[model samples]
Target: MAERITLLVGGRSTEHDASLHGYRHVLSRLLAEPDRIEVGAVCYVDRAGAFHLFERAPWPEREEVLLGGQTLGPGAALERLRAADSFVFSLLHGNEGEDGGWQGLAEVCGITGNFGPVLASALAMDKHLQAVLAAALLPGLRVPRSLLVRPGSFDAGQVLRRLGPGPLVVKPNRMGASLLTTCLPEPSPSALAAAVREVFPYDDQALVQEFIDGREFSCGVYKEHGKFVDLPVAEIVSSGFFGHAEKHTKGRAKILLSPENAATRKMRAFSQSLFEATEMATFARFDYIVEGDGIWFLEANTLPGLMSGSIFPMMLAETGRSIADLVLSAVSECGSRPARDKVLAYDISH
Candidate 1:
């Protein structure tokens, strides 16, 4: 029997549009290989946190608001999810989608899916925490030095002092796709204050790191037949630091299918180490900054984008694995995992 598959895309995050692209890309790829699995439904979680379902995959651009269909409220969505014999491909990015909230929901509702376990997703989402974990697990790993700025307690002077004298990268600690991320020439108190203030509305905590001017690269890690393996490294040559524009906007950045240079070898090793240390499941992507031979650990994306042009898919293509291949592999591995007891009600009877 063909496995029922639902691609969960769009979310209440800055990366919602990117998720839409990824959904369309993956859905199209899966459709091309029809005998492998059944593409059942596409669910779009809009910016306002509403669940809209489509019997057929909605047009990526036109599918914004919940159209005239069976709009699944929170409870209904959960119930449907728990009851279906389907693989939920969560192509969501940032915050509630990728920052463990969705994974936690699956855990609470006992739904089987890919991405990773709840703890791994939670650990990988926070920049500061992931860096701290890498430092502890992989000693001498050159991670960028940074400090966390919590809400209502962002002291600019204190932040500048910790990060020291250098170009600084200020970003939301838990956000991805480089949303609200900025680079300053120097970690001046005023600049740091302004950046943190801008970042605060999106997240409760922000990360400030010393900017390292180096070659940017990303490598993918995935379980092939139950063993973790590294994908090809893609060197990102961007006009500037790869941020929102470079990521979402086409032609803003160039990707090179790099050879097995010293950087790629080290990155592959780092990717495996980070994946193991984080206890990541199924798949992940680790980003790095290479300054000569010294590789600086940037971050790990638990739910990396699967858009056709995205680095993850590009790396997979270099390895001769299509999007359908990845989806099939995930389904084969995750389909048998025992489901958790579903939550029947929320106790909102007040």
Candidate 2:
């Protein structure tokens, strides 16, 4: 008998749609391998933060069938989740889903989800914290010179003075998919202030870093056996800024599989080290920038998109790995441990 899988998609985050797209791709891949996969159920979290349960529905293709359903409140959803003997695949992006919120809940519920533990998820979700940790753990690694801004204390003048001149990248500290990411060619004090204000709606904290003009690349990292495996690196050749628009649009950016070279090798090494330092497990994608100076860490994605044009899937394909490989690996790692026993088992094993 095939193992059952409970795929969770959609969240009350900015990347809710991205999660839905990822679920579509993942669902299609699992359906292709019926002998190994028995998609037992799917739980959809609407933008309004409502949980709806669907029975005998493993496939989600239409809006009516996908969005319209018997509303199962949080208590019922958790009950169904706990009742199933399934590997929970949290394909959520952005805030509550990927930012250690769900991971913490899983821990409290004595369940171990697909992503890493709560600490790892939280660290990776906060870009500023991750950068600080990376710098401390790997002293030789290069992180961009930047300033961290909080909600009440966004001193644009002070930030500019410290970061120096123009072309700074302002981004939300805890969000992904490049949402609310902006590149100001000439970021005056007013421009920086406006950027911070623009990002305030998404996150309470924001990061302002000196924008490096160089090649942007992303590498996928997954843990197997007892070590981390780095996938082929892919460079993003974007016509303009590689923000949310460029990320989702198919033709906006060209993803080229970077050959094994000094730069690519360095990126892979850094990625593996970062994964270890951040305590990331299962799998993740680390993005970087290479300029005349050196390779600089951009940010890490704990739950990267598995959409048709997502970079992680493209990079895995370069190494002859498919979404099936990822799914099977997750299933094998999660095993048949019951949700109520996972935390205790994890404690004993560690």
Q: Which candidate is the best by TM-score?
A: 2
Candidate 2 has a TM-score of 0.92
Off by over 4 Å in 1: 56-61, 336-350
Q: In model 1, which residue pairs have backbone atoms overlapping below 3 Å?
A: 110-340
What lDDT would each prediction earn against the true structure? Answer: 0.82, 0.82
lDDT of 2 at 233: 92
Q: How close is candidate 1 to the true structure, as a TM-score?
A: 0.92
Across residues 1-350, which tens digit of lDDT does each residue of candidate 1 receive? 67778778788888887788787788778888888778887777888888877766543435634344568898888777777768888888988888889988987787667756888888888999999888888775789988888887878888777667889999999889889999997667887888889998888898988999999988889887778656889889998878888877889999897888777887888789888877777788989898977889999998898887888888788778888778878887786445556668766776
TM-score, one value per model: 0.92, 0.92
